[model samples]
Every structure is written in C-alpha cells, then in structure tokens.
Target: MLKLFEIVEDKSPKDRIDELRKDIERYNYYYYTKNESLVSDIEFDKLLKELEELEKKYPEYKIENSPTNYVGATSLKESKFKKVVHKKPMLSLNNSYNITDVIAFTERVEKNIDSVQNELEYVLELKLDGASISVTYENGELLRAVTRGDGVEGEDVTENILAIESIPNFLKEAVSLEVRGEIVLPLSRFKTLNEERLELGEEIFANPRNAASGTLRQIDSEIVKERGLDAYFYFIVDAEQYGFKTHKESLEYLEKIGLKTTGVADLITDMSIMEKRIAFWEAEKENLDYETDGLVIKLNDITLWEEVGYTTKSPRWAIAYKFPAKQVTTELLGITWQVGRTGKVTPVAELKEVELSGSKVKRASLHNMDEIIRKDIRVGDRVFIEKAAEIIPQVVSSVKEVRTGAEKEVVVPTNCPVCNSVLEKEDGLVDLKCVNPSCPAIIQGSIEYFVSRDAMNISGFGSKIVERMLQLHYIKDITDIFELHQHKDELMTLDKMGEKSVEKLLGSIEKSKSRPYSKTLYALGIPFVGKFLGDVLAKKSKSIDVLASMSKEELLEIDGVGEKVAESVYNYFRDEKSLEIIQKLKSFGVNFGKVAEDKKDEVKVEGKFTGKTFLFTGKLQKFKREEIKDLIESLGGTNLSSVSKKLDYLIVGEDAGSKLKKAEELGTVKILTEDEFLELTKE
Candidate 1:
C-alpha cells in the first residue's frame, strides 16, 4: 500500500508520478464505475491536485489516458448495456471555491472573445450535485440516454431513464437534439431509501448523489422507478445548430419542448449582481429539496463559446463556483457509547469543537465498530468530519498523516456502558445491543420516545422533564407517565414547577389518555413497528386483547406486516413485562381498542371523499395530524404514506417541504388547503 504521507525524497519524479496515477485511477474506478466513494471529496481533490502538479512539473511523465485528462472512469467491461459514443464529448466544468477565480475566468473569457462586438452577459444556474447524463431525442421521440462515462463513451441507460417521471419520452415539437442534464435523487426519497436499506441490513448509500448514480445503473428498472429519481435538463449539446443564440434561450426552449429544467436561472451583465446572487444562494440553497454544491456561471452568448473554446477536460467558457467545503479536519478526543430505546448501543466520537456548514459540531457518529476499524480512526488522531445532508455530523475518515505515537486504538465494549450488562450482537446485524431491558438508558430512551409527538403527543413532556422525573423517582416507565397526577404536590415543590405549571403538566398527561388507539400502540415502543404499521395493526386486530392473542402466522397474514415485523410484534405481546405494562396502561383509562361503529365519530365507507387518496405534509395549525387522518378516514378517503403519481390530493400546511414540490412536479395531484379540503368534504 502506498502511504499518502510517505517520504518521497528517495523516489524519482517518474516513480512518484506513477504512484499518484495508480492511486487516482483506483479512486476513479471506485467512485465512477462502482458508485462507491473510497475517500472524501476533499481528499480526492488533494490527490488529483498533486497529480496535476506533478504532470505539469514533469510533462514527460504525462500520458493521454491519465486520470487528470479524462472526465470520468471508463464504462465497466462487464456492463450489461451496450456502449454508445457521444456526438460531442461531455466535458466537465472548471471549479472555483473563491470569488477571485470567477473574476479571473471572466477576464480570460473577455480577453479571448471580441468584446467590441458583443456585450458580455453571464447566466447562472444551480450546480446540482448528482450524476451527469446525456439523452438524445430524435424527431420528438426519446432515443437513448447514456451516462458520462470517460467523456467520450458511456453505457446505455434508456430503460432506467424511462422510469424517471420528470424526463419526457416525447418532445412537444419534432426535433432531433442531444441534451445534457443531471440525474438526482431528491432528498426525501434518499432518506426513505436509506431507512429501508437500514431496516433490511443492507449497506446504505453515503449520499444522494451516490444513491442516484447507483439507481441509474441498476439493471432492474423497477428499482429505478420505485426510488423516484428526478432529472433537470440544462444544456443542448450543440445549441448553435438548433438556432439558439444564448444559453438562457436554449434552456427556455428545452422547457418549451416538455423537458424539465431547474427553472432557476439569472442572466446578468453586472458582476456585482452575480456576486450578490451567489451569496444569496449560499444560504438559500439549504431550503431546496435537491442538493446543490455550487452555482454554474456560464457565458450567456452561445456564439462566443466557439471563441473561448475548451480545455482538455473542462470548458473554459464556464466555471463552477463551489461552496465552502463541508468537510473539516478536527481532533478525535474520545469515543462514547450511547444506548437507544431499543437497547442498541452506538459509538459516537467526541471531537474538538469545529464549525461545519454554518453550525458548531462537537460530536459525530462513528456508526459502528466495523466502521471504526475500516476507517482506522483512533483517539488523539486528526479526522475529517462532515455534516451529512447538512445535518447529523459524521466522521468521514482519519487523517493518518497527523497521527502521533500517543494515539490509542478504540476498543469495542463487551458490556453495556450504563447498566454494566453483557452486550450481544445478533446475526446478520452490525449493531451491538444490551439485552437488559431494565438499563436506565434504555428505560429513559423508551419513555422519551413514548411521549414523542408522533407517538402519544404528550405536550410539554420533553426529554429533560422525563430525565428529571426519573432522577427524582417520580417516574420509571411509560405507565408512570399516566400516573404523574398523583405526584402533583411533589412536582410543584421542584424548581421551575409552580402550581400552575404542575397543573398544566397533569392536564397534558390526562389528555394523552384519549389519543387514538394507533398512537397508543406506537407509544409502546415495539421494534420494527412505526406509525404506519401501528395504524395497520390497530385497524386489523381492533383491540389489544385480540392483538396479544394472535400468533406470528396470523400477524403475518395482515397487509404491510412483514416477517420481521410480525415476529417482533408477536414476541412483544407474549413478553410478560410488556403485558404487565399494557395491563397497567389499560387500568389508567387509556384507549386500547377502536371506537364503536355506532359512535358519532365513526369512519364511513362511502362518503364524498370515497376513492380519493390524501397526504399531508408540514406543520398543521387547525388540526392535529391524527385528527386530520381520522377526519379523512371518516369521510371515506385513504391516507398515503408518501407522494406519488397515483395520489389524488395533497393537503399542504405551512412550511410544506419536499413532498409539496414533488406533488407539483407530478401535475396529477390536486393541492388543497385545510379550508378547501373541508369544503370538498361538505360537497
């Protein structure tokens, strides 16, 4: 193995160049062909930078097939699809992280083009962080779509491209042209995909870009379709041939031809306005559903592009203004173990406080012992950490070059960190779990989850309150939450708990008992049973007694109940401790069964909302989520878990996020407000 920090004084320039080439080629193979990143983007850029400097210093060692001289790795030899040659090479854009580089690029463009004849104009578009692809349309019909493999040739992915709803199969006008765009997995879909992968014990993708790349290359088109991949067309391969004069005009034509464009473009002649826009998007891009690492600034005039020309690998007429690097190097102080509600213990890294993506990050997740071993992370070592998706800081890799002899290896613990009980690892799983249900950490975590908004919605019952109650011996389990009114006098004696505050807390606990039966089941903290599954089980069995009496086979017969979920639910109901807790909860006046059919609020089968599927997103002001769901069901409508083309209505509330955007793109879903939904029900 060639060490990046190894002394190179003994090696000749040719030897060093060869080593750099080998490393870069291997990284490219993993990143491009396999859709797996072997190193962080910063580290990869460092290697490529070193390679470029070496090849520049000693041009004799440079080769045409060098990694620096190509756009991406070549197509896989064992690829199932046929390879197609590109009409015009899909060149990459030169990247700049500072405003000075943008100024220098514009100066160079002005010097190359005849400024006396044309006024300089620049168009700015979001640099979508995704997989680059080129699609060719012939006579208004989709011909083929190809990846940007090795710039000149790529694998045919027409079948997978067809699965993307955003990409049109036929143009609005009869035209033959090759269009280039980026295929991206929306952040919402990316999250769901990783969650599903985690549940299945599969290796989840590191980011949305990798997820999109892997999905686009899947041989199974069904997988591609189900993942909800989206694409945004940006450039016409040869805009001059189509009589388009400017880049902005070309994008408008693409939209006119039924192709999906990002719909965010600004054409400005003043450099001051460009700078302002760049600064604006730096903060505003966080709100977008798709990921964007930078902005693409290009010369607006298509005719001038011929004069500016291109470099060997990237175009000279355009530059990508990369945002600040999210990954930062920090010291790994120590490792800590955390126990979750399900008794799964996780390793977390305590790091020197560092700023990342506009926030102070003091800790990062190590994921597991296997990941720690694979990354070679250790105490006292400098490691690179980044916020995944601008949230959830995680250690990317350890900087071994800065490691000192004083560094210590991180050892996996054999016992629970809190309860001192032996830990166990299940087969086919990476997590180490403490099976002691009585562990304080587990008890506290489960209690906190039980009172969460998605579970029981116990207002003002936060983690701090739960911890305080447990420390004071006022509560120990979920059942104790309903019994907190008995401690009203004691609670009032504590600091910050006045008579009014204690009364309010007691009132909230009393209100939680009337929550829907589905929420009660979810609050039990059963493994593998989330909100949707809880609703499914509640509707099927109707009562706690029926569900407890059901066998694993009987549970598996219900729709949406998988083998693992059925097994977990069956085992939970049979557990003596779980039954005791349930019995206690039942004795406290909590609803454990569905409402009777004769009740005034009973659900209807054939009302005005029949045959309609509805989904709600964002924060509701007029009604609680469960209340809205019940209302929809009572009006004979079905609730959907996610946004899809089949959805009939999407009732959006304030601050609606990606689901609202996705529904708008589908053009089939009818968006409504709370008042509008109620009006339709009345009709």
Candidate 2:
C-alpha cells in the first residue's frame, strides 16, 4: 500500500510524480480491472492529488499514461466483445477544483476567443460519475454501444447497452449519427444492489461508479437489465454534420430524437451568476438520484468549439469545475447517540467544524454501531466524511494512518442515551433499539414525524413547539395534538406562544383533522410504512378499525405491499397501545377514513378547462397550488409540473421560473395571466 507521508523529500518533483503515476496506474488497474482495491479511496486520492499538482509544476514530464489523462477508467474491456472506433473521438474535460481555478479557466476562454466574459454564453452540465459510452443510430435503428476507451476505440457492448431502460432502441428522427452519454447507477438502486449482495453473500461494490462500470462489462445482458443501468446523452459526433450549431441545440436535438438528456442546461454570461449556480448545485446535488461529481462548463457556441478545437485529448471549449470532493478529512471531537421515532439508536459525529461543498458542517451520521466498528472510527481520530446526498453528512472512513495514541475507541452504549433503558437488538438486525415505548426521545420524535409535511402537515407546529409542549406537560401522545385547543391559555404562558401564534397553531391542528386518512396512517409512524404504503393501505382498508384488523395475507393482496410492510402494519395496528391511541383520535373527530372533499363535482358540465392540459408555476395569489390542481382535476382538466410541446395552456402566476420560458420557447402553448385564468373559470 502507498502512503502520502512516505514520499521522499530528496527526490525531485518529477521523479516523485513518475513514481506516484506508476503506483496509481497499478492501483487503478487492480481496483477497476480486478475489482480488488489495495488502498482506501482517500489514500488513492492523495496520490492522484499529488501527481496532478506535480504535473502542473513539471508539465513536460507528464507522460501519455498519466492517470489524470482519463475521465473515468483508463482501461476496461471484455475481449469477447468486438471493438469499434468512435465517429469523432470522445473527449474528456480539464478539471477545475476551486473558484480561482474556474476564474483562470474563464480568463483563458476570454483570451482565446478575444471575447469579453459577458459576451460568452456558457452552459453548465452535471458531470455524471460513471462509465462513458458512445452509441450510434442509423436511420432510427441501434448500431453499437462503444465504451470511451482511451478516448479513441472502445469495446462494443450494444447487446448489454440495449437493455438499459432509458436508452432508445430506435431514434425518433431516423438520423444516422452517434450520441455520447454517461451510464450511471442511481444511488437508490445502488443501495438496493448492495443489500441484495449482502443477502446473497457476495462481494459488495465499493461505490456506484464501480457498480455501473462493472455492470456494463458483464457477459450476460440479463444481469445488466436486472441492475437497471440508465444513461444521459451529452454530445453528438460531428454535430455540425447533423445541422446543430450550438451545444444547447445539440442537447435539444438529442431529446427530440427520443433520447433522454439530463434536465435543461443553464446558460449564463455573468461569472457571478455562473459561480452562484455552481454553488447552488453543489448544495443540491445530493437531491439527485444519480451521482454527479461536478458541473461541466462549455462554451454554448459551436463556432467557438471549432476554433477551440481538440488538444489530442479534451475539447478546449469545455472544462469541468469539480465540486469539493465529497470526501474530506476532519477531526472527530466525540460521538452522540440519538433515538429516533422507531427507537433506533444512531451515532452522530461531533466534528471539528469543516466546510463541505459550500456550508460549514460540524456533524455527520455514524448510522449504527456496526458502521463504527466497520470504519474503526474513534473520538480524536482524523476521519473522512462526506454528504451522502449533498444533504446527509456521512462518515466515509477513518484516518487510521494519522491516528495518535491519544485517540480512544468509541464505546457502543448498551442502554438508550436519552433515557436509561436497556436496548434490544432484534435477531439479524444491526440496530440496537430502545424498546421502551414510553421513552421521551421516541415520543418526541414520533410527534415530530406526525406533524411533518408528508405526514399530517400541521403548520406552525415545529420541533421547538413540540419540545416546549413536552416540557410543559401539555401533551403526552399523538392523540393529544387534536385536543390542544383546551390548552390555549396554558400554551400562551410559554415563550413565543402569544395569542396570534397560539390561534394559528391550534387552527393548523384543527385543519390537520381534515387531511386524508392516508396521511394519518403515515403520521402514526407504523414501522416500515411510508406515505406511499399508507396510500396503498388506505386503498385496501377503508377505516382505521378495518386497518387494525387487517391480516398479513390480506395486506399482501394490495399491489406493492410486500411481506415486510404487511407484517409491520399488521403488528402495529393490533398492538393495544396503538389501538387505544386510534380510539382516542376517532373520539376526537379525526378522519377515520378518507376525508370527504368539500367541493361537489359538476357532473356532465362543459367548459374551456375540460380536456385541456394546464401547467402552473410560481405563487398563486387566489388559490393554493394543491387547491388549483384539485379544481383543475374536478373540471376535467389535467395539471402538469413541466412544459412540453403537447401542453395547451400555462397559467402564469407571480415569480414564474424556467418552465414559463420553456413554454414560450415551444411557442405553441397559450400563456394565461391569473386574471385571465380567473375570468375563464368564472361561472
């Protein structure tokens, strides 16, 4: 294994870079080709970072085999599959790690084209971290799937690539051309595959990228289909040959040809706006299902691309401004155990504050005691942490190499941290749960979950209010929420719960009673059940009493209800305490079944809204978005989230976004103001 601190200072930078490159090449082959990693990703990253830095210091010494020359894997091929040459060679992008590097790249572009920064319209795309693939379509039929091998020739994996759901088997335009895309394994699918691997006693993939790469190289196409690989096309071969002039136009062409491209690329001229967009994406990237390592910024003009041309490798028109590595090293101050609504105890890392992506992060989830043991993380240890979804801070690995004797092993608690109750571990489950149903932390967590947006959606009832109410003994269980009107005088005595706030909070609780019965089912925190499953259960069982009596076999009759969800829901409703709470809620006039709608449907009525497709964006002064959607549906109209060529009308509200512009760009849809929409709806 290689170590960063072991580099010999006496060796010249060039000499060390050569050694590091050799080591990296050997490791990359072992990791990518052999799927056997000799060093941790952090250690490998350190070597690559050093080699990259040294290459800048001594560019002349950078050889053809330098690891930094490639976008993903340097070499991956299945010899049985025939090889094909790319129509126009696939290109890689130069990487920029920080804002200063981006600025330098910006300045270089301005100098190269003799255009001011504002004059250049730059388009930014998500740099999907996966295997690059090129596919050709001749007269709307599939040709071959080419890997971006050495950026020139690649193996033909058409059989396997054809199985991907998102890839088009035939093009809509019937054009004889080639398209390039990145094949990715979504994060959710990756987790599912890992769980399946663990169950089957197989070697788990190290990351989503590895899984995607390995899956594409598999001999059996059936395995590829089972893995659910997806692609997003980014480029076209000799796009000028196809009459596309701009990068954005090329992307739109790809979409028009029945191929999937990622959501629209943002066009920007101002550097400040571009940087802000980058920062926004850096924070929001976690929300995406696919793994995106950075944004690929390209000159939107195709003429500039011809002038910028190629450098034996990457296109000069583009550079990838990589986000701060998801993995970063920080010191762990300590660990705290938190009890969730389900009584699962999770370890949270208290960190020496570090900025990740964009914001200051001081905490990361340890997940469970099993994770702590697997990573060998300890208090006072230097740990590698990253956002799992650009949202959840996760401990990736511990820096054992840099650990001092002072670091202490983390002790897993046998008792609940919040309440002094002995924990119980179910057979085959890694979680240690506080089975004490009366635990304060569990109660509060359940209450918080019950009032959450996708649950009962009780506005003005936040975590702080729950905490204060708990302290004041104003509530003990979920049923008590509906009875809060009786405590209005008592609530007003507390901090911030003045007359207006109290009224608003009570009003929200009252309003929550009218929420669909499925929401209440979700809010109860039935183990292994969510809003979707709640809706499923509600569809099957009409009332809370019937739901309580539902058998596992009866529950399984519902589509999408599996054995686990069925058992959880069955056991929960049958529990005495659960039944008592339900009985109380029913007595309090809560919706025991689907809440009936207030507005009567005008059956057999004819109007302009009938049979028309409508899309809404921004704030509506006259109606809530949901209310409008309901009204639209009631009047035989369809409401959509996005703009399309088929869209008939767009109801413009205040502060409309890109959807409005997209609608205008299509030039077929009617744009209606709020006043016009209201007039049309008037009886």
Candidate 3:
C-alpha cells in the first residue's frame, strides 16, 4: 500500500494537509513505479481532490513538490517561450536482432564492469513508434512543447500538444521543469481513425506510426486535439524544479504530475541481464498496445549516465534492442492447388509483393478447403503470411476490406493435378486426398516419403534427386527404389549425376530395405499411423504380421493408439495391394520384428526427438554435424527443416549459415556445442 499520509491520524487540519502531500506522492509511486494498485484509480483521484481542497484551505501547506502543482492555469500569451538547455542529452537505444544479441550486450557490459553495490537490473520500455518531443512548464502554467527534430532545435508544438487531454494545463504547485516523452495514439484509437478514413474514401495511413506522425504535424492545433492524442512523459530534462538525483526518481516525480509512463522499466547494473529483458521484449512486441520496435535500455545511476554520456548520434549509457520479423502482410493475388506427398490436393495462395521477416514471399500454403472457408480469405484481399516457426510460408489472416472486388472465389479441385486421380475429401478430416496409391503422383510422393525422417532416415536423398528420378520415370514405387541399382548407368546420364552420387544414392536405397518393420509401416503412408503409433505396435507385437492381425479393440489396448488410428492401421493392412507391397519389402530384406531378437537392446534413441523442433546455426568446433543432430534426437527434439521462432534452439557451428544470424535477430536461444548443450540438461 502507498503511504498516503506520513502524519499521525490525530493531526490537526493544517498538519493533515502536510500528510496529504506524502499520501499523493506515494500513490503516484505505486501506480507508476510499481505497476501496483493500493486503491482504485477513482479512489486515488478522490484523494488527490481532497489534497487539492486541503491545500486551498491552507495554502501554507502547499509544498513545491506537491502533486497538485504538476498542472496549473495556462497563461494566454503568444509571447515567444524561453529556450531551455537539457542537462543531459537523451540517447536512443541500440536495436536488437534476437535475444542472443540482448544477452550478448549484457555479457559485454558485465565483462567490462569491475564491480557493483546493488543488484544489476535493467528496465524494459516499449520503444514507441510515434513523435518524440520535450514539454516545459513554468510557474505552474503551460509553456511550450518542442519536437525532437535532429535531437536539438525543434519546431514549437506547444499549441498542438495542449490539445491532448493527458497533458496538464496547470501545475498543482508552482513547479517548473521540462519533461521528454513520445506522443502516440492508442492502437485501438488508431485503428478506429484509419477505419473512418477508409470509410470516408480518404487516403489511409500505412500504419499507426505514420498516422501519429501526420496528426502531430498538422498545422491546426485543434485538429490534433480532435484526434484524441495522448503523451506519456518518461524523462526529466530539468532537475532544479524537482529534487531528483536519478532517472528513476525523475520518473516517479513525473508520475506525481499525472503523466503516463511505461510500467515495465527496471534499474540494472549488469548489461547482460538487461540484454535478457530486452530480448524478451522482442518476442513481446505484438502483445503491446503501442508499437515497440526495440527495447530502450538505460544506465540506472544518473551519475554514471553523465560520466558515460553522449557520442555523436547516441548516448553510450543507453541502447535499443530490436528483433527481426519473420511474418509480414501482403495482398492475396489468388489461390492455387498442389498435390502433397499423400496425393492430398492442398490449396496455396499467391501473394502480391510482400517481404516477410527477410524473405520475399510470393506463395504460401492455405492448408486446405476448410482453412479457406474458415479464414474467409478471398483473392485480392490483403493477408498476413508467415514463414511459420516451421517450414513453408502459410497464410495466417486476410484484410477483408482490402479486397478490390476483382478477386474470385477459389473452387476446391475435384481431381489431382498430377495424375487426374479422383480427389477424395476424408469424412473426418479436412484434407482432400487421392487415395489411389498406384497414381504416378502417389509414386513420386512415396519416394519423397521413403527418404523422409519418419521412414528410411536417409541422410542424402533430398527433393531435387527425387524430382529428377520421378520425371525420368527411373523409379516408380518403393520396389523400384530397390531396382535403382540396375539403373545407375542411366542415372549417370542425367544432369548433376555422377558415378559417386549415383553409387551413394543406390547404396542408401539398398540400406533402406533393411530398415525395421515400424519404419516400413510408417513409410507405407498409412493414414493416422505416425511415428509414435508405429513404435507402439512395433514394440507390442513380435512381427508386422502379428500387429496386422490384431483386432481394432486389441489395437486400441496398446498405449497411445487411438480407435481412429487403429482403424486406419487395420484397414491399410487388410488391403490386398498393401499386403503385396509389404511382402515385396520383406523379400527385399526389410527387417520384420523377430521374436527371438534382444528387444531390450533396440536402437536406444527411438522416437526421442521425433516431434520436437530444433534449428542449427553458427559454428561449433566440438562436435560433427551428425553427432550434434543425433544428440538432439536422443533428447526427443525434432529437427526443423529451417530455423523459426518455434524452434527450441539454433545449434551454432563455425561458419554458420544465415539462419544463425536470423535466429539471433529473432531473439531465439541458440545452443553453442555438444558440451554446452549437455550442460543445459544438467540444469
């Protein structure tokens, strides 16, 4: 609770006025500094009103630092305001790419500093995307407000600023000082204004930042007021008016004046910890009402800030930590169809020139027909595209009103584009699949699946090779993969094909045939029978035959196998064609579960990293590529095809790819090496 009255309850009316001064100051501190509530906002206001009444009753009790003095009667004077010099130059913070950059900054600070008395703490402030300015008041009267043009001389904006209600017209006391802050529109208000503009057929602002800047620069002050702009005062440029020895203290004093300030600032001595706070903000940007491009990190001690002051463009005492973006908005040009690995007909969206994070995205996955209807996304609508924290650019949302009306409604394709197979939308599922396994498109997809992680776990056979082989018709089915050994000469004739590469690919194919029954089962593309279910049945039964013979009730009895999954598994095995394929695989030396084999010594890391996503970046001298990846898998971490915000870590290697830099910029935690990673598990 805030100390509203420092005096005893039995004090006289004059002494009560003195007590009210401390009471209001403490309440202000609680609201601004602590982000805590002792009383309701209305209750605090009532106390402030009572204090104002007391001061009026006994003017002698009105102190220079009383909260009542923060505002006062405005003088009707067009006279030129006096120029005031700032005691310390306020500097901008360094923007961050990711949390690592924030952490790195903190580490640098800790490495350079010798010692500290207080716990090293840092304040996190939203870097408002609006006009920056300084406002001054003299003898409790509204004086002048100046723009931060070039960080020095600025155009007079006092008339324009006064239009804002949050800015006080008079001080409760005769206090005089200069306060610096950003003037911005709340996100809700900005959206409403933009919507109104659009309805009126006026030119719409590109974003809230643009809108705030344009509104503040209007020639007419009344127009600025009419926009309902608000200012959040955060820093004090003058100290003589209020007895403040530190930046934090000045913020407290400003709060007493009823200026809105950030609720998340902290005092920090260690730059490393401050870096962590800044990094957290990068991930927290979308959650804030006001736009924060980066974090504003300031030196806590005002004395230290003075000593380690200004450079040419920024102050050494502060830095801004900025995060890189991954998803961005663009216009939806149209929707198209693509056949997936399971011969599923999926809808995709083509975008109109928008850069997401850093990539220029022109195409995005729309998932399926259901997603299209669910999102109500139409062609020509402005949409948000995310190069998801996983692979693939995905359509996340559509700007409904941005439609040009030339857009057409997309029709779900009835036939597979690749082989003209009848596309069947599953009853319980949203995906439209071409269930004909013998379709040429299905064959190509099977090959793609065969080398996938859940199947053969082949290290080398990537998409390009699969596409080339599919186009040449060099291999048609899983059986044809075994037959690739006979076509090495023909394969060498293709572009980028050589004896060594062909030999390696054929060798991988030969080795894939020796994979466990579970992998072969999973590789067969049985719907709902994923890696986990495969593992369950593989362990529960002695062989693939026994597992296939199990009833639906018996299958569900196995842990992790649901009734729907069991039905799919049971039905797939019951197919004569599927049984024939399994026989061929068995003949090709694909290992079945042997009852006599040592089940206890099976591959120790099965299904560990089967689903968890991971990213690899930077350089590591300690472990080889395969070793690092194998370790991650051992811990149940799934390796993502690319680095994204959802990734657990970006394992750094020497001469790392752009992913490391990108991950760091996004504030994703990066793992250094095998040893460093192992250390994390210990914790």
TM agreement with the true structure for every prediction: 0.45, 0.45, 0.41
Superposed by TM-score, candidate 1 places the C-alpha of residue 248 at a distance from the truth, in angstroms, of 21
Candidate 1 regions with alpha-carbon error over 4 angstroms = 1-325, 539-541, 549-554, 557-559, 595-683
Question: Order of candidates by lDDT, top first?
Answer: 1, 2, 3
lDDT of 3: 0.65
Q: Encode model 3's per-residue lDDT on 523-606: one tens digit a residue.
A: 777887766456557756657777777778767645456677888988988999889977887787887776334433232234
Between candidates 1 and 3, the lDDT winner: 1
Tell me how far the alpha carbon of residue 201 in candidate 1 is from the true structure, in angstroms, after superposition.
Answer: 50
Candidate closer to the true structure by TM-score (higher is better), 2 or 3? 2
Q: How many clashes (backbone atoms < 3 Å, residues ≥3 apart in a chain or on different chains) does model 1 have?
A: 0
Lowest-scoring 10 consecutive residues by lDDT in candidate 2?
Answer: 596-605
lDDT of 1 by residue, 403-512 (tens): 66899999989999999999999999999999997899999999888887667867456666778889998888999988788888888787656676677668878888
Model 2 TM-score relative to the real fold: 0.45
Per-residue alpha-carbon lDDT of model 2 for 397-471, expressed as tens digits?
988898779999999799998888999999999999999989999999999889876678775566666777788
